[model samples]
Target: MTKKFVTLDDFLGTHFIYTYDNGWEYEWYAKNDHTVDYRIHGGMVAGRWVKDQQADIVMLVPGVYKVTWTEPTGTDVALDFMPNDNKMHGTIFFPKWVEEHPEITVTFQNEHIDLMEESREKYETYPKLVVPEFASITYVGEAGQNNESVINEAPYDGMTDDIRAGRYFDDNYQRIRK
Candidate 1:
């Protein structure tokens, strides 16, 4: 039972832009970090949280075939083949508080974006094709939930990824210079 278009091999070990239904996008890649749970070798999925460009690796289980992340939040975030279609579809989750929705319809494509300050100059701005492709990963919000709460409630400590991303604000709640 093989699917059309992309397959397991084609989707893994490559770079793709993960687009969420709420218009949030991240540059994604993966590596098999040898951790096991329930016989599933954990896959470390690295996603750059584009707002300030911080990349963090999150553990996802049941990933050898269809990359699933359910252990972290007790909510299953899975990636599966889009039936009757050719692209990959699934629920993409970020580290702990970064993503709080049950899940968001995540679409992965061959689209790539280099967040390096120097690399951004290589291409001319094109019309965003990623915007229209985001469909709700959740059955509830067709557009998914807003990410502000997750960002706001996240702890502002030196250990947090958000702190490294320079997303902190002043005592008055104004964004400080990164």
Candidate 2:
């Protein structure tokens, strides 16, 4: 991850252009010095490497999002994206571990994620399979609609307005723990 800490922006409930480029990572080390430099192999064209990216507005909220990817061998996965203060926390629920005891769940902070090889390969491979896919967020509202202003309602406990009402759900969308 480039940044040690990721401060959450206003992307809580708003869907906007989210872009990323993946390429061969090259780290150059000086012959006598340990200092290194990194670059993308095919990152530029002519004199510039136009990075590949997919831009789409993403409304990330605390809830379960289904993963429909190609790769017939790969199983399904769900993500629970939670926004706390300036951090977006996520819990990955792999299909194989959903039913297994001591579920093999992966939890990490989004701010600390790098589109490069820093994060899980799934983060890069899965999304690339589909373009402009709507990432359904679990926002609790009156009639199936959620807004940014509403946080910590049903499955999520808001850190900002002291609105710790309703019970919270785990990464697998289970209310096992409050």
Question: TM-score winner among the candidates?
Answer: 1
Q: What is the lDDT of residue 134 in candidate 2?
A: 20
Angstrom error of the Cα, residue 77, model 2: value is 3.2
Instruction: Give a tens-digit lDDT track for model 2, residues 24-66.
Output: 1111111111111111122211011111111122333333121
Candidate 1: lDDT over CA atoms? 0.29
Task: Judging by lDDT against the true structure, name the best candidate.
Answer: 1
Q: Report RMSD for candidate 1.
A: 19.0
Clash numbers, per candidate: 2, 9
User: Candidate 2, which ten residues in sequence have the lowest lDDT sum?
Assistant: 27-36
Query: Candidate 1's residue-wise lDDT over 1-178, tens digit each?
Result: 1422233333333323333445443332332221111101112222212221122223223222344443322223455433223234555443332232212211111122322212223332233121123332111001112222222221222313332243543433334555
TM-score of each: 0.28, 0.19
Global fold similarity of model 2 (TM-score): 0.19
